[model samples]
Structure formats: C-alpha cells, structure tokens
Target: MKKLRFSAFLAALMLTTLTACSTTDSGRRTVGQYVDDAAITAGVKAAIVNEPTLKVSEIQVETYEGVVQLSGFVSSAANIATASTVARSVNGVKSVKNDIRLK
Candidate 1:
C-alpha cells in the first residue's frame, strides 16, 4: 500500500508540473487574466439566460482576454443578435464575437 501511494503521488506531481508549464493556444495568460476571462464568460452566460427571448439551453459562451465568443444554434437571427448584444453589455468584455447560427 505504501508503494502504491508513492506511485500515485509521483504521477500527480508530474501531471501538475506539465499543466503548470502549458500555455493556451491564444497565448499565455496570467492567473489574474484567466480569472477575468472566466468572470466574463459567466457574465455573458447569465445575460443570455436572463434575456427572455434567448434560449440558454441552445447557447454556449467562451471568453479569452476579455473577448466573449458566442457560438451555438439558435432558432432565429434575432436570437443571435440578442446574444451578441447581451455579451457586449457585460462589464469586463472588451469585444463580442457572435458565431451563433440559425437552425
């Protein structure tokens, strides 16, 4: 049991080291920047869900460096537009990319 525990600990240490050295394709982000992007993504999703006309179940939100990206299938062009508008209204979002498509 002690040997198995040591092996597991070693594996976890290696995994943590690899992840700590990894950089996202969009480029490297400081921990603070990553947190900001996460907040922006959450805010955009909240806005979409809050909008009565938007179907939150059909929308996806992603944010990087303060730019929010909305990509998913909506029932109409208006929903796509509304999603973009809502994302842009978020406080930390620097820009909005609407890639929503009509079904």
Candidate 2:
C-alpha cells in the first residue's frame, strides 16, 4: 500500500512539473491566452489608425487568439476592404474577419 501511494505521488509531481514548464510562444511570463488576444487587438487598432480610408471611430476591433473580428459601419465598401487589408498587414495577425456594414 505504501509503494502504491509513492508511485501515485511521483506521477502527480511529474504532471505538475510538466504543466508548469509549458509556455506560450512569446514566452514573456506566460500571461496566458489573454495576452495573445490583447496583442491582436492592439495590432488591429494600430492598423486602423494608419489606414487612410478607415476611420478609427467607425470601427470596433475584437481579437481571439490571433484572429481579428472587425465590426462597425463604414462609408463604403472600399473603406471596409481597406480596413481589412490594413488589419491583415499588422504583425501577429493570423486572420481578418471583416464584418463592417456599408453605410
């Protein structure tokens, strides 16, 4: 019975160690999944600010992992396309989902 208990304890210790050692890609203190989402959000916001045809006030940016979800009203289809293109150009952006409604 003592031997079985020791084995189980060792197994649990190994699992804990492995879990603690795992980390995200950035490797900056492993801020967890929220950090990745925040990075994408910041990237999208920066892209929108730099895009000539897309006004920052007219769009909302939400990010999950590296995928960006853009939703809002824009002046024209060209503006929407421009926004999506701009968002895609941002670093660390895995995908762009443009859900902007044309006004």
Candidate 3:
C-alpha cells in the first residue's frame, strides 16, 4: 500500500511539472505573445506603406518569443531603417533584428 502511494505521488508530481512547462492556448505561442506579434506585423506593414522611399516588394514579419524578425528586400538602406523603427515603436516587441536587404 505504501509503495502504491509513493508511485501515485511521483506520477502527480511529474504531471504537475509537465503541465507547468507546457505552452499556452495559442499552440506554440501564448495569447499575449500572439497579440504582440500581430501588432508588430501590422505596424511594420503600415510603416512600409507610409514611407515614400521604401518600395517593399515582399515583407516577411516573423516573431519568436517576443523578438521580431523583419526579412525582406527594399530599394535602399533608408527603407530598412524605417521598417526597424516601425517595428520598435510597437508595444511588446523585445527586439528587432533587421535582415532586410537592398534590391
């Protein structure tokens, strides 16, 4: 009886630990993280559109664990700076790594 009780306790402890480490409702990303990523993407797109010098053919915005990665090709360096600025301005973006290249 004592052995069974110990096994059950160990199982419960393992279950609790696993649950604590599991990802939240947004599949791989938490609810708050998802919202932040969406906000960052929207802000970057808006900035690209508003900037007259930047002619972005394809804008790829990816967020991983609150870090936003901006990948695309633009006409000039100024466009890249503009995009980075746009991403930084959005709330919840921990950092922006600009991988944008000049076309």
> TM-scores, in order shown?
0.74, 0.68, 0.60
What is the C-alpha lDDT profile of model 1 across 15-89, one tens digit per residue?
987776666655688556787899988888888889999988899899989988889899999888888889899
Comparing 1 and 2 by lDDT, which wins? 1
True-vs-predicted CA distance for residue 58, candidate 2, Å? 0.5
TM accuracy, model 3: 0.60
Model 1, position 47, has a per-residue lDDT of 87
The local lDDT score (0 to 100) that residue 67 gets in candidate 2 is 84
**lDDT winner, 2 or 3:** 2
Model 1: residues with Cα > 4 Å off, grouped in runs: 1-27
Clashes found in each candidate (C-alpha, N, C closer than 3 A)? 0, 0, 0
Comparison by TM-score, 2 against 3, better one = 2
Worst 10 residues of 3 by lDDT: 50-59
Stretches of candidate 3 above 4 Å error? 1-28
RMSD in Å for model 2: 8.2
Ordered by lDDT, highest first, the candidates read 1, 2, 3
Q: Write the per-residue lDDT of candidate 2 for residues 1-103, one digit (tens) a residue.
A: 9999999999999998876766666664444566778987887898788877779999999977788999999989999889888888888888989999988
